[model samples]
Target: MALLHRAELRPTKLDLLAAWLPSRRWFHGPAGADIVRVAGFRFDDPAGAVGIETMLVRAGDGSVHQVPLTYRGAPLEGADGWLVGTTDHSVLGPRWVYDGCGDPVYAAALAAAVLAGTGQAEEFFEVDGERKYREPSMTIASSGAGDAPVPAVGPPRRVVDADPALIVTDSVELVVLRCLDDGGGERAGAMLTGTWPGQPTPLPLAYAVPR
Candidate 1:
């Protein structure tokens, strides 16, 4: 279960995204444009080493964009280029945030969810010594590859970004979809999909196809 903190974050998630979004090719907006977070969901990191999240944001022009993020306790080794920035968390003390595509933790979690046919983890909060679950704004799903049906999640050796397929692991090639697309790829080995709040249909979020 993912825990929600009631404390304040020094720079804030929106602030970091606002600064980083302007630098990405997919983001179409002025640097000062007001970004509204529409919907999001979290993927579990089995070891709890990193906090994985994906947010769907509306740009100034009302265009929707999907951003996958990973929060870590310390700076990720050999990931300086992918660092979004670090912020002081009132609850966790400090956190290092990244773009997620380059994060091994996020990659592994994506692979596991895609091949294991799991869905988004339910969010829970501790209230008066009891755990209460709250439905997320979006629903996420994943499915196994074709007939082989991956037996396990393998650690990735590297992530070579070239669209459609990104991560190279012992098992399969994981695809990272920066912007949610629903057009094609009906033949992908496995995929992680999500349905935005109030949306009846799901879109491909990530995928795992044969290497």
Candidate 2:
């Protein structure tokens, strides 16, 4: 399960994206345009250290984009290019945010979700001294069998900036869709698909191919 804190964030998530999104080669919206977060889901880090979240945001032109990010207390070594910027969390203090494509933890989680069919993490918010269950804004599933075995994934060797960003690891190549089309990647192999409020039909979010 993923634990949540009801705290304030300086230069909120959307603010960070507004500055970082236009730098992406795949970003279709105008620079400095308003970004509205539509939905999101989380994946638990087994070690419970980094925060893994995937957000769906709509651009000014009604185009939706998927952004995966990891929140950490310290900067990730050798990931200066992937840094999304820093934010001060009310409870967690300073956080170093990075695009998940360059994070090894995210690669491993994506591989597990696609190859083993593990879905989004169940969430609970700590309210006062008790834990309160919260429904996820989005849901995800995989084409692989639930009991399928997942291969070990390492840090990305290369990240291609494209409409569907590609993360090439030692064991697998992961394709993460930046643009959210209702019928994205219909003929893809093992993949992770998601459904949100307006989009009830599952659409491909990411996929993995063994090297």
Candidate 3:
């Protein structure tokens, strides 16, 4: 379960993404385009340490992009190149945000979810001290079935210069879908997928392959 606080954040998430999104190779938006968070989903850190979220944002020209982000208490050493920015959370104090594609925690969590065929984390909001489950903006589905366990991995060593963003981990290479296409990516034959709000077709989110 994911509990969302009603606290304000300095340099709100959208603002941070606005500046950082254009830096990605997959970003197709024009400079200074209006970007809005259209949908999102989350994965729980089995250890309850980091916040793993995937946001689907739409540009003013109707192009959609997928951003996987991780929030940590301390800076991820050796991840300077992957750092998006830092922000202050009213309830969580300071946060170090990074692209999940480069974070090991995110890679492992995503691998587990895909291998286990799990969906997004259940969301809950606090209203007058009452907890209420709120439906997420999108639904995710892990495609492919197999008993092969997802290999455990350490910090991402590096990213490859490929169309589907690839992250080199300890045991495998993680492929993250940087853009929202019509859901036809299957390089690894298995992937984590998400559906657009009100849509039934699943779009590829990421995949994995042996290193």
**lDDT on C-alpha atoms for all candidate structures:** 0.75, 0.88, 0.80
User: Could you give candidate 1's per-residue lDDT for residues 1-211 as a string of tens digits?
Assistant: 6877667887988889888877876665655788889899888888877889988886676456778899999998889878998899987889999988888777777776787765676788778778888788988777663445554545567766434437777766777765544433565567677787656687777777655
Residue-by-residue lDDT tens digits, candidate 2, 1-211: 9999999999898999998988887887866679999999988898899999999997787579999999999999999988999999999999999999989999999888888877889999998899999998989998874645677888889998686888999898899998996456564558888899989988889988877
Q: Which sections of candidate 3 miss by over 4 Å?
A: 182-184
Candidate 2 regions exceeding 4 Å error are none
RMSD of 2: 1.4
lDDT of model number 1 = 0.75
Q: Which residue pairs come into collision in candidate 3?
A: none
How high is the lDDT of residue 20 in model 2?
90
Residue 15, candidate 1: C-alpha displacement in angstroms:
0.7
Candidate 1's C-alpha runs over 4 A off are: 145-156, 160-165, 181-187
Best by TM-score: 2
Answer with 1 or 3, whichever has the higher lDDT.
Answer: 3
Most lDDT-accurate candidate: 2
Error of 3 at 178 (Å): 0.8
